[model samples]
Target: MLGAGLLAAAGLPATRAAAATPASTSVLISGSLASYSTFESKWNYLYPWGDSHNGSALMVASSSNHNHVSLSGGVLTLTSTPYVGDGFNYHSGTVYAKQQVLVDSSWPSWEVSGDFQAPSAKGTWPAFWLTGVNSWPPESDILEFKGSATNWSNTYKNTSGAWSNTLTPISDPGAWHTYRAVLKKSGSSNVQIQYFIDGVLKGTHTGAGFVGQPMWLIIDYQMEGSSGSPGPTTTTYFRARNLYLARSSS
Candidate 1:
């Protein structure tokens, strides 16, 4: 297992000196939909990244729309248009922190929490995940969905093995829900990733450590079949608010 501090140290990108320092960050990006698409010749957007295979795209909104996303008052939000494709099979929205926030090496434990809501469609897939800009797989899948109460799963990635488990209370895609996770460095390289739903305990993963790296948080709303279809099928949507990130004072 790796120490959380070492994990944080390992994840820093070479561009670190120019990114935001640990304390806090605040920025706003707003514009019309037509002015954001690369196809429309507007490319000044700060940090918009999406995958066609993932069947989703993201944009900045001066006011708000189907895919309006941003960070305000210490929380992140993702709002999208109504998705009609393949039922609930596909739709997603995502955003990355443009100015990286360094993990406070002084804290032995850290936590990231946020609220999310999926569109009313039956097949929408959504996630609030963390990943290392330096690697993949060992990336954290902190929160994920499958749309089936019997099949919902949350996963945590670690060096030893990929650990996963089932979850229910089944997030209502049409309404808001809160989620939180705590990663505690308890040993040389072992840490625990704890999951919470609406601030209540849901699940926990212990002894998995992939922390010795600089990582970024990702909130996404994915429409099913968007990644596998030969063409666009239907529309999908997601709405979110009240995101929280804090490090244990200990």
Candidate 2:
């Protein structure tokens, strides 16, 4: 996931401010839903060549030859393998929901929930996050595991040119855990975000100037960032299952 600081470093536009107001009463949309079993038809592999990163790993589109990403047994696997190409020494996986699977004005209130086994390798960075389809600084990172040192998940929200983050410690990152994020437009251009882990609320953040904008989901296993240089020399993997998305009915 791109942190607020990293977003700024990438020359993305700053977040805009919106007036604070009462929260919106949003409910899950009855039929706007998806899961791993239906993922392929609803998602697309993100070609990873023009993105910012300090890692040596390059993301590749899903293909028979590469097999960087795969879906089977109701689970999705994103693997990072050692490869020598484009002067880089590794290859990993990244995928995003199809453009049609966007949270826009028609469905501003939304939720993404899933079970994941976070990779614990020293130099791995895995995240389940959301970003604006047509803008920046409106990102919401539901779960981000930086490495073994940070054996926990961090949730981040960028709004009003600022970032709000909360760290929830986990004893074993390799163990499967439930992660979820619920977002609702609370005002004309503001959203209220709530993060949950294993059904327990971990954090809440409100983002300004982000309401009613189209946002897309991203799940990736990046090799390195602030985690350090020289990522795992061997293969590493991130796995997720029971992934789901839904929109508000009201």
How much is 80 displaced in model 2, in angstroms?
Answer: 0.4
Best by lDDT, which number? 2
Q: Model 2, residue 140: what's the lDDT?
A: 81
Error of 1 at 207 (Å): 5.9
lDDT minimum window of 10 residues, candidate 2:
27-36
TM-score of each: 0.60, 0.77
- Candidate 2 residue-wise lDDT at 138: 68
Model 1: CA > 4 A from native: 1-92, 98-105, 120-122, 149-153, 158-160, 225-235
Count clashing pairs, candidate 2: 1
Tens-place lDDT per residue, model 1, 80-165, is 45444453332334655442322334555667765666443434456667666565544455556644332233555544476577
lDDT of the candidates, in the order given: 0.50, 0.69
